[model samples]
Target: MRNFNKNALNGKRAIITGGGGLLGPHHAIALVEAGASVTLVDINEKGLKRAKTKILKVNDSAKIATQILDITNLNAVEKFEALQTKHDTNFDILINNAAVNPKMSEIGGQNSGRIEDYNLNQWNNEINVGLTGAFICSRVFGSRMAEKNKGVIINISSDLAVRAPDQRVYSPSESFDDIKSYKPLGYSVVKTALIGMTRYLAEYWGHKNVRVNALLPGGVFNKQPEELVRNVSKRTLLGRWANLNEYEDAIVFLASDSSAYMTGQSLIMDGGRSVV
Candidate 1:
């Protein structure tokens, strides 16, 4: 990670979806520190406000911008290309970080479920963000990056893909981490789909010099219930949820030249949760 310096992201531009949420602001903070001009996008005005305020506090001269956008807005996403041209600006990095999780999932946190019971509408919503959001953003920002012949993308992911089977409360043969994380069956399925999408983009864009990757994060502990956390931590080697700041360096590295040659891969940082 030390191979990357403060100016590694200098003069670069980034757009982080879900910028008002837990991981969004941290991404903004680290990018600004690394010298990237960032645009934080979210559907919530309050979140956007808080994110911008926090970013400016870190660097008075930070080149940070905020946009109120719902990633699933098909018309807006479709027109993004023309919009960028009209504004005389283009994005350099696209972070697909926005999502609507278990609140819509059918499992409703029951800690168990059958895939057949999945909610179709909820599944669509999750897939819309995980896949379509990334697709549209990639097309928009990626076009500009392709023009410049260089760019990077980082999709926020989860460790559920390879999380330890032994740690699950239910039978190992009957994994239900998704049911545990949020309600509904599609949560895990969508995340797994994201990994596949990342690989496809990396392969398709390699010759164009644009890299796409995913970061499978551990349970982020802020506002988490102690009991809930302890239960989750046992599966992880670290035996604890991640502090918000813990994600900063890894994200910065992926956004910078430090991991230029690395693409189309999932970087799992679940405190060894997958190994237990």
Candidate 2:
């Protein structure tokens, strides 16, 4: 309870993308508990229902709303602006948590035999969801923040953006390949680019007191079927995948006043996977 008071997010208005995903649901709860009104955005109706239900069970009266729309649709984004105006609440924090991968992993290089099926077309499809979706979210939300010179934009990224990847999933793996790791063409590339965009927006808007940053969360471990999360724990220095709860503190830090003066930096929460 003491921790809650030290850095609470009381009375803030937040918009979260990907709120239906594994990490997004938990993130939404934490924000609401901190006294913020949260708007959960996702394309999955079922996930949205589950997310909203869980939040209400905790508080039974949390000010939470869910918006179902395809982020890829620019028209929908325009409408989002209108909805915000109607509510008379300018977004105080924007979390770009929604993303999609068209065909699993991305494969690159000459020996890209595994992800051959994962071509540029498939790559772009994932990029549109994984990266471009966040791009537009940030574009509209950050633009609003610019008008007031105050807001926080937290972008969720994966460690694969900086670490070596398992190429076997997307492409082929040589028996004796020293590099061992294979990079996906779409997710890794787009996520890496996302960090760049975060930095650019941070620098561009820092003068106005708007903080733009990225949260490169390590692989999220949940009930979802993920071979990477299941099998890769042995490779981690901690020997365990990060629980979904591990992300809450990082969220509070970035969304609360604690991270004031920080911008354009990535708060990576991987459990030593990148270190090794």
Candidate 3:
């Protein structure tokens, strides 16, 4: 039997969308540490800088690049792809990890949590960033990968993609009248849509050696309110939220040849939350 190569992605290149968000940098870190050159694309310049800083701290020699662009804009994405091709920097992996996750605490108003009162603009904005952005990036990057007859696309979905959010966790009291916070409907809808896209792309590019998959992660602990933490912990089988770095290895696995046979699948690493 041939031994597996530890540096499986030594010369591989990757592009990560929403590269400046909470999990984006960590995803970059995982790919960087695994020997892949990573380009992080995001609209927020500061977040991109911060993500680069965090990755540099982990490995100063890490091959990391950042770009400011809106993934929802197809023309912008196409232009970026053209520029990358000009520089001979074709990507071997694409991680569609961008999304807008609205916090209940940050939103305010009498009916903020009510679906009937959800702002149309907010709904459009969230879907544009979360679902549409994924579609755009996959089209721009995955197409090139298909032409080359090799690549991987990992959509960063959520555990909620498989299961509906238990809105009761966001409420302060058991009474329905006292409930003032509920998870946004767009979040679940967008995440679920990603799964469908993953399947479609997987088959579309399967003959060309391009593999597509989705990563369904659970909530990460980021200093949430005590009550909220407690409520979520009680429901999770692991009795706690995942650590920020917990998904790093999984990201590397999906990116590298280690998962060569895996395609058109959803890798749920939610501490068994979806099962329970």
Clashing pairs in 2: 106-184, 106-185, 114-170, 114-171, 114-172, 115-170, 115-171
Runs in model 2 with CA error above 4 Å? 1-7, 101-113, 168-183, 223-230
Q: Rate the local accuracy (lDDT) of all candidates.
A: 0.76, 0.77, 0.89
Candidate 2: lDDT of 1? 21
List candidate 3 stretches off by more than 4 Å: 1-6
CA lDDT of 215 in candidate 3? 96
> How far does residue 72 in candidate 3 sit from its true spot (Å)?
0.6
Q: For candidate 3, write residues 1-276 as lDDT tens digits.
A: 112244768999999999998999998888888788999999999999999999999889999999999999999999999998999889999999989887666766753757878878878988999999999999999999999999999999999899989888877774456667778888899999999999999999999999999999999998888888888898889999999999988888888888999999999988888897
Kindly give the stretch of ten consecutive residues in candidate 3 with the minimal lDDT sum: 1-10
Model 1, span 1-276: residue lDDT tens: 223478888888888999988789888888888889898988899999998888788788988888888777767865755687688677778888887654222333433334555556667887888778877787777767877888898988788655432323332233554334333455676677789888988998889999999998877777655545656676668878788878888888888888988999999988887765
Measured by lDDT, the strongest candidate is 3
Best by TM-score: 3
Q: lDDT at 271 for candidate 2?
A: 84
How well is each residue in 1-276 modelled by candidate 2, as lDDT tens digits?
A: 214543288889999988987778778877887888899989999999999998899778789999897887778986897778777788999998887642223323443434645466657777898788888888888888888888999988878777756543322332335432344567777778889988999999989888988888776555433554455675678877788778877887888888898999988778887887
